[model samples]
Target: MDKKTIATALAMIPILGVNAGADSIETVSNPAPIQRASVKKTVTADVLNVRSGPGTTYSSIGKLYMGNVVEVISESGGWAKINYSGKTGYVSTDYLKSNESSSGGETSKPSGNQKSIQQVTSSILRVRSGAGITYSKVDTLHKGDNVTVESTENGWAKISYSGKSGYVSAVYLKFVEYVDEDSSGGSESSVIRGATVQRSSKSYSLDEMVEVQYIKAQNGGNLISRNNARTGEEVFTTYIIRNAEPRAYGKPTKDELRYYLDPANFEGYSSGLMQFVRLDRYTNTITADSLNKYFASKGTDCVFNGKGQAFIDAAKKYNIDVLYFVSHAMWETGNGKSALAKGQVVTSVDGVTLDKPVTVYNFFGIGAVDGNALEAGKLTAYKNGWTTIEKGIDGAAKWISDGYIHNSKYNQNTVYAMRWNYEYSWHQYATDVNWANGIATMMSSLMEKYGTGEGLLIDIPDYK
Candidate 1:
């Protein structure tokens, strides 16, 4: 309270104060903050609506885009006051991004948001009693079984099933909220609906069993199945059929190979999947209730293991291939190149950058990354650069839903990233099976290496 002391306190206010979303308090006036400077939280949402007052019912001001930075001015139980666009507003802290825009710049935290979700990841999935690892079996849920979602408990989705609340492991359900890519090109594509994909019995080669997938434009890519031709049963309320694989007549020169290898350069490497990951891992803008949707059985799942089992469980709930998801994670964290990755420095294949050369994570090439944590290093305008792998997955999901990756798919020659990159590996990569072939090939390879390859999961090739 002395004049000098008052002046010192005033100086500290600018750094200490913040405008955070709902469910959170921005400043700690009595105890003071560990560090000063209000952190600018973001709307991890692709389209976060800015509201007046402190609730969603408040009049809408404007919409916040993904990574829209805001000043955290104040906080409440689970809310934070922040500047959305040019206006001051409150948002739910449940969705408020906890990780600083900078990785390694500060210690991070998270929460539990499970048990309140009911998804159909795999058809004929089983539901259990209570949300426990040792819970008893309740019944089986076929693909497209829409059960009521409940609160997150013990890492399982507590769904209200058949007049009773039962627990369903997130692994069995893939939330149908899909990211709609703008595949404008008159290219071939297929949409698989079930949790598992089945190849017809007769066919053995890559293109044989693809009959399950419906090929759209004869651009590129093809399907493979066990049988040559068989029943057209619907998996998850959809049908998958095969088509001709695009032919990669000419080989790309060494120069073309080098271009796609670079994250900033390769069309898909940078914009396609990377964009989607950014959206998927993004935080903020969703209701606190929605936050529980991301949590697992226990707090330990989140606070440890690189956000491991919890993240795995969450992805399973969404029915995304962890390998594909993790690849993007390694891309962002630099495969440990980032200090965030335990001081492991991921390098380029040519020993240059982390994203390029080879994007690898986990035992079977998994995970994604943003860039670098906070100030470690950054990808120029990209936030969450040098950050954790999950953030990359968040970004990719967002990008895919935003139609960022599919923008260039309209024309035959337009280059695509992950959706239909003929450069990677696939038959008819350019001709008959353009986009469809590339995605199907990946799925085909996955089955060859991992599972039995029977189910509706691989039905929808990422192309068409």
Candidate 2:
């Protein structure tokens, strides 16, 4: 039950060493015909120099650090010509190692079919002048922004922004295809091509959502105890409901809270959009093979394995989203490793003595509160006669459908609704601010592994 604090920090931008201007750098005269396919080379030296020409006689224009990957244009006489920050420069071939073999004689061009569209995944992505962090930043891109990727070298993606060519870390970019807005089937503005918004009576801006859901709830004399007194940077305490350990909680910084609360951050990626997906929608795409494959991918080796048919049947019987049901169960049970997931023998429940020591299973952590999660969960399972894995799955699905998905009071049929509960904010499923986001992420991950976007419906909240 120990309270944990989490902090967010910004990265320090490195200062580039630029002694000479681009105009002063000597260009390769009558350069040999470009040969070999487009190849990436990693810098082997701690600090390699980019010279105006091929030899030591050339002036040093810039410096490249170890692990920096550069696109090699051509190589001759132990010197390699490279594309340095949109300009041509030469570096010692000895200090550069080719990432792949160069066998093809065709020359590589930044134009034509090499181009692809990519969406930014990071909250704030820096566009550097070169392919490495040491290079000067040319621009900044936010989450959900789209950029045309000309090429990818090492771990950097080459993009053209603001009439200039720049490089962004490939790790922050995701390949995305454009979807026509008209095809979205809604009037609400679609944040991403595949996601559509839905108008609601109650809506809150990103800042307002964070304030009401996290800041106000935590600071407004709530009963939950904190590890430390509230500070300017640290604003909220969130319980960790997904873990098997007891009393796991976290105090997230302001920036962390805003990142999770921002709908734009999640809407940009297909998986992130799961928060707003209606969990009651029925689909035939989900199958036992797919569910079992998802479990296999997570390396889950418990009773939940081979029970995919039970989950599918429960979802069909209760009109629940099978993917969401599986994801929720996996999250609650720590991928089916928790004691409740494994089942526990009980002789008594809620002060009611039982006739015998009956074993019960709680797959979705129903009735598992913060303090007494195990006992409460077991009692609910025992009462429902969830002595078998199939029973646990079916019973938990019914509980979720009746209590949250189809509940008249809250009407929380989606992850976002389950967490925020705009109709009844106090009736949310969990105290953890990240509870909905975590489940949505898991759902997204499972979909990416085995599901497709065909017939996918996204519901974005239209904030006032």
Candidate 3:
């Protein structure tokens, strides 16, 4: 959608000449009592100037890019006033038009049972008094904690925890199916009746390992080969189409990921099967405080202290999932203790020698690898950024945001989806079959540990 005011009579000087003024000036007199309904307009220009006043004489304070929607406040001769970036500004009336877009053409909202069971997948999930992060922490729950779901709203689950009902992030809760342990086997796995079953043990038997390996080999090749395939031929392929001069790829927001992954509702899928993840799959609610607190809980000094704010900043700036990004970082850095997290030497870039020796302060270990097979990947990331902590976080965030989480090309949002090699048969993020699942586990653990209570920030800072 685009928005702007009706152009002044003189705005047509180039097309209509000086004579176009007096008699040809188009006027939009202020509507009496104004339109009762708020007017939402789309910007039609590539870059429409946002002037401080309703005339061309007004100074340009900012810009309203094409497709940007703004509410029309009032109008003068040929100018429309609007609230731009929190301040009143005027855009040429010529570029503004009523928004005609639908809700992405969805015919109905997502449907689910009114009340259902969900398990806390986090190691320690904080129960808040309300739905938003600003709410006070009233209680806490642990990994494998079973709670009765009373209701859910806006990424939060209202549950009956510890004899009291409170709200927790729905992202950390997994839908489960409750079941009793069978007497045939001396083992018991908690089945919550409706949730996806949690894998009982991290370790597998020899037969199980062999079977997994066979499956992987059939799917691709060696485990290391799969791990090295993240930057495969598909990395060079373009997916998202941007509108800017450089025409870079665009990333998906959480909502967009949800829409694309939900095959039941959206029609843009090449495969109708919802192979990405479980129904409850989502990005955890992570913050800077969450990272710092998780680091402190480990009792080891980490470079991530005072760095949570940076992650939070980058997450918002890039529209990436804060929890997923931080969880992946923590997993790669061992809670910020890894040498790669501190900084590493980047000997070259795209196999070219740098003018001077360059070091990368990578947090997520994007291109870094231990073996000779993946050295070039590290250099590829260095050229993109990762030289410093902030650059590393932002660069890696953008990469993940555009590639794994919400790439227009692949559109794989879930970790399981990342392992899926649908289009390029060789594309996968890790060698081990459990890589995506392991990251999910780490995300839950981190959120349980630092996502709630005193560790949770009541007032998350808005960097934007």
Candidate 4:
């Protein structure tokens, strides 16, 4: 048969095994009062089938992958009724494991040293799949919402919300006394402080920042190579420089740049507001173990691995925030997988010749400029005697500290200031509009994972 005719016949063939009339299988209904205690579970199987009913006889409607978190509203026999993709579905309880306890029963109330209950104080708080902001958000909790505090770890409070066990920032949760059914008692107040915001003297409208970016784009800015002059004036373009030749940059629209530049766009999210945090401040809370964990989380396997102490030492020496310093290095070096980070042997660059070949490492892309990033970056590393990974890290930290964080003229200590330098528009760190945002996100992720949100000073620019 011809290809088209054969394809048509194949399409007409009915799917084999699955019963066509299986739609009549029992739909999910409200669970009985006794079975209504919601429990959070993680899928243990590589792939578990979600069905219309509780057994293999029922047809498969969807699938759940391993490590996927789901809320088990109820259980019967060996099947779990879970809220899957906005609809109810059933999966074998054998393939699921509870996040809190192995028993398929009501979540146990806190006892002993564990606090009984806590109230959400933030206008809106996100319940993450894991303890850190790097994890996906599972749900949200609103102000005044009371939740049973199962545990607290790494500045996150483990709680069951909307049938799902997830973590919310402990900073926004206040302790509330739990009263038994027979007893009546008043609740005590113990509110943990969240991020503190301070207004800066410098101010600029969103339009002014966008205009400054456009001006920089046209005048040989740090990373910007060309502009879409014919298309429109507001739109700017740059190149994404990998190890190879520079590739065409994405044309970010003026609106997109505005969104990235506007401080108000980040005010709603506690972590997002971290972009305005002063990077010059040093904290003793950061440890080598925490930095190692952060590096491992990013899947960094290069020479930068196990160099956490070097990063901490550099941060302390430069009086820079360890989180910012490490995150900036991770971003610049592609989580320590970039060519410059891995080290490159060089004897010469830009018509300049050296006496001997030296293997140089650049953990922070220090001298990486547009057009010739790789060569220039390696040369800069060699000149600075960054022959070792630790030396490279310390050297980069010193450079950044002197040039931007502690610079007398620029004083661009925060990510916001680095991007939108109100004092000197041309002295901004990067030409890429997303540079500050990306670094800030990394900083926030690290902070969320390891920081306790105590004594955080956020300097938000007050735009006129």
Regions of candidate 1 where Cα sits further than 4 Å from its true position: 1-377, 380-382, 401-439, 452-455, 458-464
* lDDT (Cα, tens digit) per residue for candidate 2, span 1-464: 22332222212333344336444434334346457654777667766888999888899987775545688888876798887766678999999875553576343322223455555655567888888889998766654445666667655778753234688876566544323322221333243333334433233566676665565456531123233433221121121333324442455555666776667778766557878776655556467988887777656465677888999999989876777788888877777767888989999766788888899998877888869888888888988889999999999989998888866566676887787755466777766666676687777767767775443345566566
| 10 residues in a row with least lDDT, candidate 2 | 231-240
Q: Rate the local accuracy (lDDT) of all candidates.
A: 0.36, 0.66, 0.52, 0.67
Per-candidate alpha-carbon RMSD to the true structure: 22.4, 24.5, 18.3, 24.2
Better of 1 and 3 by lDDT: 3
lDDT of prediction 2: 0.66
lDDT of 3 at 212: 38
| Model 2 CA lDDT for position 176 | 43
- Cα lDDT tens digits for candidate 4, 360-414: 9987777788798888888899889999899999999999988888776677778
lDDT-superior candidate, 2 or 3: 2
Clashes of each: 144, 0, 24, 0
TM-score of 2: 0.52
lDDT of 1 by residue, 1-464 (tens): 68999998888774445446555545544443234455655446645655687667688765544433456677765667665433467667766675453657663322322222223534345677766557689765544344455433223556654344576654344332212132110111122211222111111322322322223222223322323333311110000221224322333333433333232332222112221121121112222232233222213332223444433443444434443333333333333233333323344323355554222222111132224322223231133332344544444433332332222232111122243333223312222222222333333332234332112222112222
Q: Indicate whether candidate 1 or candidate 2 has the larger lDDT.
A: 2
Q: How many angstroms is residue 298 displaced in model 4 relative to the true structure, after the best TM-score fit?
A: 3.6
State the weakest 10-residue window (summed lDDT) of model 3.
455-464
